[model samples]
Target: MNEADALDLVQFAIWTVLIASGPAVVVAMVVGVGIALVQALTQVQEITLTFVPKIVAILLTVALSGPFVGSQISSFTTVIFQRVQDGF
Candidate 1:
């Protein structure tokens, strides 16, 4: 309803997004680094080597973390809806 309220909502939205994305991001980073190390050691330098494993790992992470991410988003939505209901 006001700047502070708007800012609060925005901040909360960002945090929710970060929380939801945390696992996937972490998995991707780890997978990417591992792949990079392997490529460095083996000197394969294949584009697919860099991308494929990272993609697969990220997909698997998302699949495994689906429920946790869903609940975080759902909770954020609930809070937003409640604010709307309260005419904020």
Candidate 2:
């Protein structure tokens, strides 16, 4: 592949990775922030309080987004394979 083509592939791969992970990470971050706010307001500064909710939110996000994530990865893989087959 030419340098430009290689760069485009790399950029596409990076974007795909970000897109795949964005939902779960964003959910976890929002949950964490909400939990922190609650703790601040209620004075319930328990460590597990923060960790548990974030973990649960992340897990739920992963579960909910599982199909989307799988499809995105599969599509990226297929594109990669097709490019290879095209002698890229």
Candidate 3:
């Protein structure tokens, strides 16, 4: 493959990774912020308090977004394979 094709593939890979990970990341971030707010208000300085809620939020996000993530990865793979088949 030429440099342009390689660049395009790299860019696509990055975008696909971002798309696949965005939901869980966003949910975790939101949960973390919420937990932080609660901790600030209630003075609960437990480390586990922050971790558990973020983990649960991430898990829930993954469970809900599994199909979407799968489809995106599969589609990216298919495109890559098609490019390979087409000789770059």
Candidate 4:
């Protein structure tokens, strides 16, 4: 409710979002970069080549990370609700 508490809550929410998404995003980015490098080296220059692998890698990462992500989000939600109940 106070300005400082509100700011902290907002910051925590942002961090939670980043933590939740970071693994998948990082995997996609790395896959994209590697695909780009391979294309550059082989002179393939196929745009779809970049997209498909990144998508697949991200999907796999999301699948593998689902439980961890869910737990993080659930914990954050619980903390937020508890704060709300505590009159924050």
TM-score of each: 0.96, 0.94, 0.97, 0.95
lDDT of 1 by residue, 7-88 (tens): 9999999999999999999999999899889889988989988888889999999999999999999999999999999999
Residue-level lDDT of model 2, residues 1-88, one tens digit each, is 9999899889989989999999988998899889889989999989999888888888898999999999999998998899999999
- List per-prediction Cα lDDT, in the order shown: 0.94, 0.91, 0.94, 0.92
Which regions in candidate 3 have their CA more than 4 angstroms from the true location?
Answer: none
Any idea what lDDT model 3 has? 0.94
Rank the models by TM-score, top first: 3, 1, 4, 2
Candidate 4 local lDDT, 1-88, one digit each (tens)? 8899989989989999999999998998889889888988999998789888888898899999999999999999999999989987
Model 2 spans with C-alpha error above 4 angstroms: none
RMSD of 1: 0.7
Q: Which of the numbered candidates is closest to the native, going by highest TM-score?
A: 3
RMSD of each: 0.7, 0.8, 0.6, 0.8
Q: What ordering of candidates by lDDT runs from best to worst? A: 3, 1, 4, 2
* Candidate 2's TM-score: 0.94
Query: Could you give me the TM-score of model 4 versus the true structure?
Result: 0.95
Backbone collisions counted per model? 0, 0, 0, 0
